[model samples]
Target: MIETLTRIPVAHYSNLKARAGYSIKIDKTEIALFKVTNGEVYALENRSPHPKGGVLSEGLVSGNYVYCPVYDWKISLVDGTVQAPDEGKVQTYQVEIKENIIFIVL
Candidate 1:
C-alpha cells in the first residue's frame, strides 16, 4: 500500500541554525524541528516520552539524539526511539526540502 502525506511548509533553511531546534505547531499538534550539526533537518513530536515535560525542542541535541531536559532520556531524532536503558518513543515526521524551504508531512 502507498501512503499519502500532506506537506506543510514550516520554515526556511536559513532560519534554522545548526545544533538548534524550533517548535512549530501544526493544527493542534506540536512538532519539534531540529537542524543537526551536519545540516540535517529532523522533525519529531515535541513531547518527551518520559512523561515529565514537553520540552523536547529545548532539549540538548547530540548527533542524532536529544536528551530530555526533565529526565535526561536520550531520544533519537531520526526515528524517535528512546535510547538504551530506557523505553518509549515519540512520533517522527517526514521532512522535505525544496528551494531551501522546509516542509513537514503530517
Candidate 2:
C-alpha cells in the first residue's frame, strides 16, 4: 500500500551545503535532503533512478542539472526527471524556504 508522506524542516543556509546532502526525518522516514541552489532546495529520493546507487547529492551541477556519480547520469535538479539516456524518474519532494531555513515536503 502507498503511504502518505510528511514534510519536515531540514536545515538552514548556514548548515546547508552547496549541492551537498543531508538527512532529515519526515513521518518516521529517513529522507535524503539536497541543497541544490540558494533559496532553491531540491528534494529527491535517496536512491538513484539509474541502477542501484546513491541519488547524487554530491553530483556535479552544470547549468540546471546534476550528474549522478555512479554512472555519470544527469538528473534534473528542478524536478528529478531522468535526463536523456537515463530511464525512470526518482521521487521528488516539494521544497520551500523561509528565513533561510529549508523546508521539505516529502
Candidate 3:
C-alpha cells in the first residue's frame, strides 16, 4: 500500500559511491534511501535499531544488506531484517523510481 508517496516522478538519481547510503528529508522525517546496486534501490530507517545510533548515510552496502557503522550490525535493506544472530530490525520503506526520480512510499 503506497500510502505516503504523493507522486511518482523521476528522482534525482546520482551515481552513489560503493557501499554508501543517501538521505532525503521528507515530511519532517529524516529518511534514508539506499541504492545498493546499479539496479536496486532500498530505503530503510535512518536510525539504527540498536540504541540511538544514527545509521550514517554513507554505509556499506553488501548484496541486500547494509552494515550499520555504529555497531557493525548487518541489516537487510529489502525487509528491515537483521542479518543473523542479532535480534533487531529497522523500518523499511518502498522505493520506486520512474524515469530517474525516486518516489519513496512510507
Candidate 4:
C-alpha cells in the first residue's frame, strides 16, 4: 500500500543552526527539529526513552546522536534509534527542506 504524507511547514532554515535543535508541538506530539553537524536537518520525537523527560531538543548533540539531558541516553538523530547499550527508541519523522523552509512529513 502507498502511504500518503502531509507536509507541514515548521520553520525557516535560518532559524535553525548547526548542532542545535528546536521543539514544537503537533497536536499532542512533541516534535524536535535538528540541524546536524553535517548541515543536514533531521526530525525526531522530543521524548527521551529513559523516562528522564522530554528534552531531546535540549540535549547535547554530537554528530548524529543527541545525549539525553536527564539520563544521558544517546539517541540517533538520523533514525531516532536509541544507541546500542540502551534499549528503546523514539519516532523519526521524514524531513524536507525546500528553498530554506523546513517541512515535516506526517
Candidate 5:
C-alpha cells in the first residue's frame, strides 16, 4: 500500500537564519530544522544517533552536515546518515517552502 504524506506548516522562512538550527515538534516527534547558507532547508530528528544521543538542533551546521554537540559525530542533514567512524543514522523529514512558510512532510 502507498503511504500518504501530510504537509504540516511549521515556521516562516524569514525567521530561520542561514546555517542555523530551529527546533519544532509534530505530535510526539521533535525535529530540527536547518537553513543552509545556500538557502536550502532540511529537517531531521532532533536527537542524534550516537550511543549517547545528543541534540541535533544544538549541533553545528557546516554545509549540509551537522556535528552532534555531545559527541561531535558528523551527521548529514540531507539524509540523516552519521559520518564515517560513526555508525548510526537519524530520521529525516521532507521539507517544502511556499510563500515563505515552511512545511514538513510526514
Candidate 6:
C-alpha cells in the first residue's frame, strides 16, 4: 500500500528565531522544529532516542545537532541520527516554508 503524506501547517517562519527549537503536536506525535542560522527549518521527533528519553525541544541547538537535555546525546536534526558514541535515532519529518508559513510533511 502506498502511504499518503500530509502537509500540516505549524507556525510562521518569523515566529521561530534563528537557532531555536519549537515544539508542535500533530495528532499524538510531538515534533520539534528548529530554524537554523542558515534559514533552514528541520523537523524531528520531540523525544530523544536515549534509553532515558529526553525532550528534544528543551535540548540545546548547535549547528545541525541538538544536545539531549537529559543524557546530552547529540542528535542530528537533519536525519534524526544520534551522534557517534550514542545509539538509536529519532523520526525526522520533511518541512517546507510557503508564504512564511511552516508546514511539516507527515
lDDT of each: 0.91, 0.70, 0.72, 0.89, 0.94, 0.93
lDDT of 5 by residue, 1-106 (tens): 9999999999999999998899999999999999999999999999988777899999899999999999999999889998898789999999999999999988
lDDT for each residue of candidate 4 in 1-106, tens digit (9 for 90 to 100) = 9989999999998889888879988888899889987789999988898856658999989999998988899999987788889889999999999998999999
State candidate 5's TM-score. 0.96
Candidate 6: tens digits of C-alpha lDDT, residues 1-106: 9999999899999999987889999999999999988999999999998877899998899999999989999999899999989889999999999999999987
Position 13, candidate 5: lDDT: 96
| Each candidate structure's count of clashing pairs | 0, 0, 4, 0, 0, 0
TM-scores for all predictions? 0.93, 0.74, 0.81, 0.92, 0.96, 0.95
Ranking by TM-score: 5, 6, 1, 4, 3, 2
Clashes of 5: 0
lDDT of 1 by residue, 1-106 (tens): 9988899999998899887779999999999999999999999999999857658999998999998878899999989999889999999999999999999977
Which runs of model 6 end up more than 4 angstroms from their true locations?
1-3
lDDT of 3 by residue, 16-96 (tens): 444578877776776677776566777777877877675646567788788778787888888887777776888787777
Q: Provide C-alpha RMSD values for all models, in order.
A: 1.3, 3.7, 2.8, 1.3, 0.9, 1.1
Checking candidate 4 for backbone clashes, the offending pairs are: none
Candidate 2 C-alpha lDDT tens digits along 30-60 = 5566665653567777667765676566566
lDDT of 2: 0.70
> Which residue pairs come into collision in candidate 5?
none
Against the hidden true structure, what lDDT does model 3 obtain?
0.72
Error of 5 at 13 (Å): 0.5
Candidate 3 residues lying further than 4 Å off, grouped into runs, are: 1-5, 8-10, 15-18
lDDT ranking, high to low: 5, 6, 1, 4, 3, 2
